[model samples]
Target: MTGFEFIAKAFKASYTDIAKRLNMTPSAIADWASGRRPIPKDKLPLVSKLFRIDEEYFKKKELTEVEKIKIEINYLERLSKRDTEQIPDTYTDDEGNQHETYFWYNPHEGELRYKYEELAYEELVLRIKRILTHDFALDMEYQRTRNHFHVVKELTELLDQDDGTVGIMEFEDISKEEAQRRRNLADRVNSISRMLYFLNGGKLHAFGKIDEFDEELFKLLRKFKIIDTKLPKKLKELDDPFDHRL
Candidate 1:
């Protein structure tokens, strides 16, 4: 059963009541129930929490390691398709600088798909982080923006190397070039920053204040379903906890 159906059954509520609570129309809730429309990721947690159900239980399936890898590959395939379809033809500007600009038939749909892919990537990263922390006993610490940028940079570097094997080789022996490539790949994968900003009802600003940074990051974590990813003990001990804040 879909999450909406589960929630409706568990709460013993009418579709109208659930719709009112979710700020959606009854038809929308019924559509989700009937699989006529997919549940938007943002509302999944809210529904789960309201119903007091384990969030993971509402997930489509328990993704295995192999399945996770396959998902990443699928994301790459989608990215390739998007790039091929949306990217503009190369042209030289007045300054003699050649550049390409992507054109999209539906820019909004493109943005939505990009965010969906980013959410998948973030889920994989969290899984990897969990494995590193629990299985390998690494002294891993999650610092949201700080740690995410660091890991993205390192992974990008690994993926860029000519002879480097970022995912193929052992993490310790990954070459500098490979690390760079991996970092770049991760950055691209995480480029849903714009989508997160839009979803949070904020405009993309070149320079953001501290409050904006916090809100943006929280929105990103919520969008990617990574709010539960373990944080550093210090951050975890803060007065304003990160868990479930979104």
Candidate 2:
């Protein structure tokens, strides 16, 4: 039997009587009775004690397959939230050194600065997807003025070298295979960035119109069977102003 059914049978109380006794609205009681609402944890103990029912009666039952899947999806969303959180303005390192990080947000001027040093390629891709789905996704002012493309460009530069160097600055060395894996990831990110740039109406250099970058991205998309495989036709239709820099 459902928890609410058990509660009613044990207490010999109508839904309205239970609502009045618990200081809750009758609709809430009805919701519980219909299994439209799960019993609040704090109310569980009161339910058990007042009705002299076993606490186990109110305990959550084994989840169905669909319920299990929902729980798993919620857990994965929580994990993603941790990674996609905006970088704080300032933070202290484990070594006790304090550092000020750049995290600008000026809606009036249409600007947003995002720090991406700690983000992995997978997380970055997710962030790009979220950005694309934002209410301001098609806003030309927000798209062109925002620092999103700048941050993505920086990430591409970081993936270029074996030592994770951006410019002349070097970091710890990684294996050749690992370096190539990063390059491949960077290529994916670069492809997404280019797509965004085009969608945002950015102008492109004439000679830079159809380059290796577009060819690579086009091939990648075709392999994944996402959009149309024909690059030139798609570009011509969009009046494709490709910006290879981003």
Candidate 3:
């Protein structure tokens, strides 16, 4: 976990909360998390004091396979405990853009208010973050499992030996359970790759890159994902409200 994540979860605070407490902008917090830039020297002390964490505690490090799996499982549990809401569509503008102001038939009011109000909509922001975090944790697990089985396969090839005797032995000496487990892991990696590709509109960029997280693009992807994952089920419910088989 990054320092930013640790602070947020431990404090039960949003990004804005951390930013306000540290006298920094929320985008700057996002940047630090994404590694667009490191924490400024001037602010590092304040952050350390605020979180009561030393440099060793906040330093960036790779998570182990067990840590990755734990993150994925914990997020999965959070996902299962939470319920999803189906939001109605926003209205379209004359310029073919969607706006909440269309609901009031006053685009000016919405335009003036949405930017500020959306920032303060803490629950909505948390919900979006929750889904994104879970998906990312799954991707991390897939990468971990793929690397493990790949090394296993490579090492197993070196075990091939030339012998004068013609006795038959199980080739490569991989246990039946291990072979089945490798196959299953491989299948999981493929399925996860495909799911991420489909959900992100096939952009197919690498995850966990040390680049800036474009907030606009993140919001766009979130909208696309919500529509993809929630719309079909919502439509099915509307068609048959009594059907309990989600």
Candidate 4:
């Protein structure tokens, strides 16, 4: 599904046009498309934005039945288009094999963008249901500490105290049991927020962008009494346009 050919055809945008938009050479994009090289991390967002899709869409994942049907529908729609370029650019593969690659700038890119978004929402909703109902652990590993949930390889900078015990920021003088509870609360807030941020298929989160998911996010956090968790306050608040009150 990450194949550049599929992307070019599926988006109805030619590899040449995409490469031009990215200021990259056509052969380089072809290499990425052909899997001769893994897509450069630096260019991932650029490509994702150029296509109005999350970079996750370019990663290989098992598609749901509905997503497969979307793919099929897009394919059938492609079959109905008769305005594709008559002559295709010849693409040379890593094996020195030549292939014809057609260019199509149909009226389908906008439709494709929305379709990807719909798929993303479907995936997000499905994951939220599972995480809340069935998969209690969310399947991520963690370590129990007196002052932190201590997820493996994350949140390493827990505030160190004079007595060599970890603390969540300046809560070092709090009773040991209460300190542990606060730290656990902070960990849950951090962990779940991280989980929801990357949305699996939804948003292009992080990288210095305002997380529009916040209003609903923090509201959900209050369920477990994350009232004392230490996180940066948002500069401005967003109204939850949708009823995500849980």
Best by TM-score: 4
User: Candidate 3 residues 30-128, lDDT tens each?
Assistant: 777655677787887887777555544344544433333333334333443453334455788789998653221321222223222222332333443
* TM-score (all chains, Cα) for each model: 0.23, 0.26, 0.26, 0.29
Kindly report which residue stretches of model 2 are placed more than 4 angstroms away from their true locations once superposed. Answer: 1-120, 124-165, 169-172, 204-209, 212-246
Instruction: State in Å the error of residue 240, model 1.
Output: 80
The 10 consecutive residues of candidate 3 with the worst lDDT sum are: 102-111
With a 3 Å backbone cut-off (N, CA, C), the pairs that clash in candidate 4 are: none
Model 2 per-residue lDDT at 207: 24
Candidate number that wins on lDDT, 1 or 2: 1
Question: Which pairs of residues clash in candidate 2, taking residues 3 or more apart in a chain or in different chains?
Answer: none
lDDT of 2 by residue, 88-138 (tens): 688899999999887643221110011122234445555655665673656
Q: How would you encode candidate 1's per-residue C-alpha lDDT over 1-246 as one tens digit per residue?
A: 554464455335788988888899999888877667767799878867665555554454234433433443444444555655555677899999999876754323433343344455555566558654554443445544455566555445433434333333333443486457557756654454443344445433322433445545655665576554333343345536556653
Candidate 3 has an lDDT of: 0.47
For model 2 the TM-score comes to: 0.26
Q: List the residue pairs that clash in candidate 3.
A: none
> What are the Cα lDDT values of the candidates?
0.53, 0.52, 0.47, 0.52
